[model samples]
Target: MTEEGDQEEQTILTWARNYAKKHHWVLNPDEKKLGIVIRGLARNKQKYGEQYCPCRLRSGDKEKDAAIICPCIYHEEEVEKDGSCHCRLYFRKDALSE
Candidate 1:
């Protein structure tokens, strides 16, 4: 993935972390004094280059394309194509009041 893509993914993950914290969800197992909640998710990276999967990009299903595509590419979840959906693993930090 490109630098831009990595940055974007991090940004989204941050939001998810905050969202889970707001809902009092145990995103991470460890805890700290400041109580800065953290959320984590597994991301899939295929070994084969010729293989294709949603991990390359969200294609709205069709992830189980080929065995060469590797297994468990990004926590597979059905996201809406409405254009505004941040995705199931996504959460906007500003979604809740600070």
Candidate 2:
């Protein structure tokens, strides 16, 4: 990857880490997979003008789709019920042990 791409990835990772911390959540420990999802978020931000979750299908309605933006409305519920968000990016630390 180019230096620029590397830097962007780092930035995204940092933002994700901090965001997860704020919510008392943890990011998946698998760095390789996390990096891929971070890149997807960056791409979505560039393409759609918002960081929509890459794992989700866009309905093309900006208002409806807004809910799927990073730290989507479903994340809390998903993490609580499924251990991780649908994309398996952010996960509850307790879930890792189970």
Candidate 3:
């Protein structure tokens, strides 16, 4: 990865970490998984100009696609019910022990 890519990924990771803190959640405990998700987010931000969810397909509609960006509209419910979001990025604190 180029230095630019590295920087972008770091920025995303920081944002994600802060977001998780605010929500009282945690990032995926697996470092490999966390890196993958961060890379995906960075790639999307570079390619489509938005941090689209790596685990989902985009509809090609900006307004509709906005819902799938990094902190997607579905994340809360997913975390609340499944312990983690679909992308496995954000997890409930207790979920890590399972």
**Rank order by lDDT, top first?**
3, 2, 1
Alpha-carbon deviation at 88 in model 3, angstroms:
0.4
Which stretches in model 3 have alpha-carbon errors above 4 Å? none
Model 3, 13-67: lDDT tens digits are: 9999999999999999899999999999999999999999999999999999999
Give candidate 1's error at residue 50 in angstroms. Answer: 26
TM-scores for all candidates: the values are: 0.31, 0.89, 0.97
Clashing pairs in 2: none
Q: What is candidate 1's lDDT per residue for 1-98, written digit by digit as tens?
A: 56754564465456556755664432322244112211112223222223233334434354444432312233222221221112223222342222
Global lDDT of each candidate = 0.34, 0.88, 0.97
Candidate 2 positional error at 96, Å: 0.7
Better of 2 and 3 by lDDT: 3
Best by lDDT: 3
